[model samples]
Target: MVNLIRNENMKLYRRWRTWIMAALMIGAVLIGSFVDWHYDNKDAGADDWKTQITQEKQHWKEMIADPKTEEGSKNYAKDQLAIGEYRLAHDIRPESDTMWSGINGSAQLIMLITLFTVIVAGDSLAGEFSTGTIKLLLIRPASRLKILLSKYISMILFGLLLLIVLFVVSLLTNGLLYHFKQLDLPLVSVDSAGNAIELSMLGNLWKSYMLNGVSTILFVTLAFMISSAFRSSAMAIGISIFALFAGAIIMELTQPYAWSKYMLFANLDLSQYLNGRPYQDGMTMTFSILVLAAYFILFNFVSWFFFTRRDVAA
Candidate 1:
C-alpha cells in the first residue's frame, strides 16, 4: 500500500498539470499579498476603510479624554488608548498578520486547492483512458478500486500541498513587499487556555498554517466527489467551483429555504458556522463537525460506488 501510494503520487506530481497548478497556487498567494500590501502600506487617509478605523479610534479617544465623561467610559477609553498606542508605536495596520492568515486560509486555499484537486482527482481514472495509461495501470496486478483509492489519497494530499505553497508564498511576498521583518501575534488573552500556555510569535504562524491545512482537506473532499463523476478534468473543476458559488447564492436568494442551512459551502465556512450570527441559530463547532462528517461519508460512498462501476473503456 505504501509503494502504491508513492507511485501514484509521483505520477500525479510529474504531470504538466500538477506543476502548472502549483505555479498557479503560488501565483494566487503572491497576488493576494500584493493586494493586501497595496492598501496596508498606504497612509491612513488613502482609503475609506482606513479613514474609518482612524476616525473611530480618535472618537473613542476623545470620549475618554473628555473630562466630564463617566468613570466607566473613561476606563474603556483608556483600554482602547493603550491598544491604540501599541499600534502607533509598532506601525501595524488593523489586520497585519491575523487578517492575511485568515484570508489566505479560507479564500485563497479553498479556490486554489479546489481547482488543483479537480485536475488531479478528475484525471485519476479518466486520464488512464484519455492518455492510454489505463492498460499500464491495470497491468500492475491491482484492482480498479485499489487504484482509485490510491489516487484519491494522493490527490487529497496534493490539495494540502496547495495550502502549504500558499503559506510559503504569502510569507515571502508579504514579507518583502510590506517590509515587515517579524510580527508579534497575541495568542491567549490570559483567558482561553489558562495562564500556563502562552502562545509565542512563531506559534501563531504555525497555528494559522495548520488551521489552513485542515480547511483545505475539507474543501478537497468535494472535489474528489465531483472528480469521481466526471471524466474531464475541466468539468470536475467547473462543477466543484459551481457547487460552491451556487451554494452561497442559494443562501442569499432564498433565506426561507431552510435547506440552504445544510449546503456544503455554508457548512464549509467554519467561522460563520461557529459564530452562528449570519445564519440562523444553533450553528456550533459540533454542528459543523456533524455536517462535515455527513458530507464526507456521503461523498466517499459516492466516489467508491461510481468508480467501482465506471466503464474503464468509456
Candidate 2:
C-alpha cells in the first residue's frame, strides 16, 4: 500500500499540469498582495478609525431610515452597526495595515484552491481510462481497491500542497509589502449575548484555514466521484465546478425554505459558526460537520463502487 501511494504520488507530480497549477496558485497570491499594497496601505490611527466608524454608523442609520432600502441591505447595515459599536466600546481600532491582516484576508482565496483541486480530482481516474493507461495500472499486482484509494489519497495530498503554497506565498508576499507588525493582535467576535470577545489571532486563522480546507475536500471528492463514474474528464470537471458555484446561489434563493438547511452547500460553510451566525437559526457547528461527513462518505462510496466494479478495456 505504501509503494502504491508513492507510485501514485510520483505520477501526479510528474505531470506538467501539476506544476502549472502550483505556479498559478502562487502567482495569484502574489498579485493579490501587490494590489492590496498599492491601494489599501493607508495607516489608520485611533482617531481615524473612530471618525470612520462614526461616519459609517451614520450612513447605515440613514440607509435604515430609507423606506426604499431592501430588507437584506438593512440587515447588513444592522450587523455592521453592531460591529462598529462593539469596536468603539472595546477600544479596538480596526485591524492595522500590517502583513498579518493581509495574510488573514488572503484566506478568502481558498476557493481558488478548491477549483484547481476539482480539476485534478476530476481528471485523476477518467484521464487514465481516456488515455488507455488504466490497463497498465490494472495489471499491477495491487488490488483494484488499493489502487483507487492511492489515487484518491494522492489527489487529497495535492490539495493540501496547494493550501500550504497559498499560505506560504501570502505570508512572504504580504510580509514584505506591509512590515511584519500586528502579530499580537486579537480577532474580535460577538458572543451570543451580543458582547464582543477576543479570539487569539492564530486560533482564528487556523479555524478559517481548516474550515476552508474541509470545504475543498468535500468538493474535490464530488469531482472524484464523477470522474470514477464517467469516462470524460471534461464533463466531470465542468459539472463539479458548476455545482460548486451554483450551490451558493441556490442556497441563497432557497434560504427561506426550511429544507434548505439540509442541502450540502448550506452546511459546508462552517465558518458561519465562528461568527456566531449560522445559515439557519437552529443550525450548529456539530450539525454541519455531521452533514458534511455524511456527504463525504456517500461520495467516497460511489467512487469506490464504480471504480472497483466497472470493466475497463484497452
Candidate 3:
C-alpha cells in the first residue's frame, strides 16, 4: 500500500499542471501581501485603534437602536458591540495590517487549494480509464480497493502540501513586509451567549484553516466520486467547481425550508459555528459535522462501488 501510494504521488507531482498550481498559490500570496503592505496605514498611533474601536462601538449601538433594523441585524450588532466593549476594557488592540493579519487573510486562498484538489481528484481515476492505463494498474499485485485508496490518499496529501506551502509563504512574505511584531495578539469574538471571548491569534488561524479544510475534503470527495462513476474528468471537474461556487447561493435560496439545514452545501462551512452564528436557528457544530461525515461516507462508498464493480473494458 505504501509503494502504491508513493507511485500515485509520483504520478501526481510529476504533472506540469500540479507545479503550475503550486506556483499560482505562491504568486497569489506574494501579490496579496504586497498590495496589503502598500496600502497599510503605517502612521496610525496606538490611540488610533482605540478611536476606531470607539467608533465601531457607537456604530453597532446605533444599529441596535435603529427601529428599521431587522431582528437578526440587531442581534449581530449587539454581538459586535459586546466584542468592542471587551476590547476596550482589556486594551486588546485588534491586529490590523500586521503579519498575523496577513496570515489570517491568506486563509482565503484555501479556496484555491480546494479548486486544485478537486481538479486532481476529478482526474485521478477517470484519467486512468480515459488513457487506457486502468488495465495496467489492475494487472499490478494489488486489490482494486488498495489502488483506489492510494489514489485518494495521494490527492489528499497533495492538497495538504499546497496548504503548508501557502502558510509558509504567507508567513515569510508578510513578516518581511509588515514585521513580525504582534505575535502575542489575541482575536476577540462573541460567543453564542453574546459574550466576548478571546483566543490566541495563531491558534485561531490554524483553527480557521482546519475548518475551511472540511469543505475542501467534501468537494474533493464529491469530485472523486463523480470521476469514478462517470469516467469523465471534465464532467467531474465542471460539476464540482460549479457546486463550490453555487453552493452558498443555493443554501441561501433554500433557507426558507426546514430541511435545507440538512443539505450538503448548507453544512459545508463549519466556520459559521466558530463565530457563534449558525446557518439556521437549530443547526450546531455537531449537526454540521454529522452531516459532513454522512456525505463523506456516501461519496467514498459510491466511488468504491463504481471503481471496483464496473467493467473497465472500454
Candidate 4:
C-alpha cells in the first residue's frame, strides 16, 4: 500500500497543473495585498472604508427573507445581537469589500481544482487502458482496488497541499496588506442589525480554515469518480466545472428536484457552513454537507467496483 501510494504521489507531483494552481493562489494573494496597501495609505480619516461589510450584509439579507431555516433563524438572531454588542467596539467594518469580491474569485478556483483532481486521480485507472499502461501495472502483485485507492489517496493529499499553500498565502497577505494588524477580531454576524456573536479573531480564522478544507475534500471525490469512468480528462474537467456553475441554474429552473442539495457544487462554500448560514431554506449546513459525504462514498464504490471488474485486456 505504501509503495503504491508513493508511486501515485510521484505521478501527481510531476503534473504541471498541480503546480500552476498553487502559483495562482500565491500570486492572487500577493496582488491583492498590494492593492489593499495602496488603498489603506491613500485614504485617511474616512469611514466609508469600513462600510463594505455593512453594505454586503444588507444586500445579502435582502436576497433571502429569513431563509426560514433553523440555522438561519439562529444566525439571524446572532447577527442582530452583534449590532448591539459591537456598537463601541472597533472603528472599522467587520469585513472589506475587497474581501467580499476578491476572495470569491479565489474561492471559485477551488471548484476548478476539484475538476482537476477528478481528471488526474479518477483517470488513474482508466488512463492505464487509454494509454496501454494497464499491462505494466498488472505485472505487479498489487490488487487493482489497492492500486486505485493509492491514486485516490494521492489526489487527496495533493488537494490538501494546494489548500495549505493558499491558506498560508492568504493569511500573510490579508494580514499585512490590509491594515487588520490585530489577530484578535470580534465575531460579527449578518443576521443581526450589526453585531450578533463575537469570537476571538484567531478562533474565527482557524474555524474558517478547517471548514474550507473538509468541503473541498467532499467535492473532489465526485470528480474523481467521473474521471475513473470516462478516462477522458477533457470530459471530466468540462463536466465538473460546468456542474459547478450549472447545478445552481438547474436547481433554480426546477424546484421540484429536492435532491439538488446533493450536488457537488452546491456545498462548495465552507464559510457558509461555519457561519451557520443555510445553503438553502430546507437544508442545514450539516445536512447539506452530509449529502456531500454520501456522494463521496457512492463515487468511491462505483469507481472501485468498475475498475476491479473491468477487463483491462492488453
Once fitted onto the true fold, the runs of candidate 3 whose alpha carbons sit more than 4 angstroms away are 65-69
The candidate 3 region of ten consecutive residues with least summed lDDT is: 176-185
Ranking by TM-score: 3, 2, 4, 1
lDDT of 1 by residue, 43-157 (tens): 4452344455577779888897788998857665665555555544545444453344434433445555665676567667556666777767777778867877887788777
Rank the models by lDDT, top first. Answer: 3, 2, 1, 4
Best model per TM-score: 3
lDDT comparing candidate 2 with the true structure: 0.84
lDDT of 4: 0.61
Residue-level lDDT tens digits of model 4 in 97-180: 333233323444454455555556545655666788778887799988888788778878877676666666666666554444
How far residue 3's Cα lies from its native spot in candidate 4, in Å, is: 1.9
Best by lDDT: 3
Query: How many backbone clashes does every candidate have?
Result: 0, 0, 0, 12
Cα displacement (angstroms), candidate 1, residue 111, comes to: 2.3
Tell me the RMSD of model 1 versus the true structure.
6.3
Q: Give the TM-score of candidate 2.
A: 0.86
Q: What overall lDDT goes with each candidate model?
A: 0.62, 0.84, 0.90, 0.61
CA shift of 233, model 2, Å: 1.0
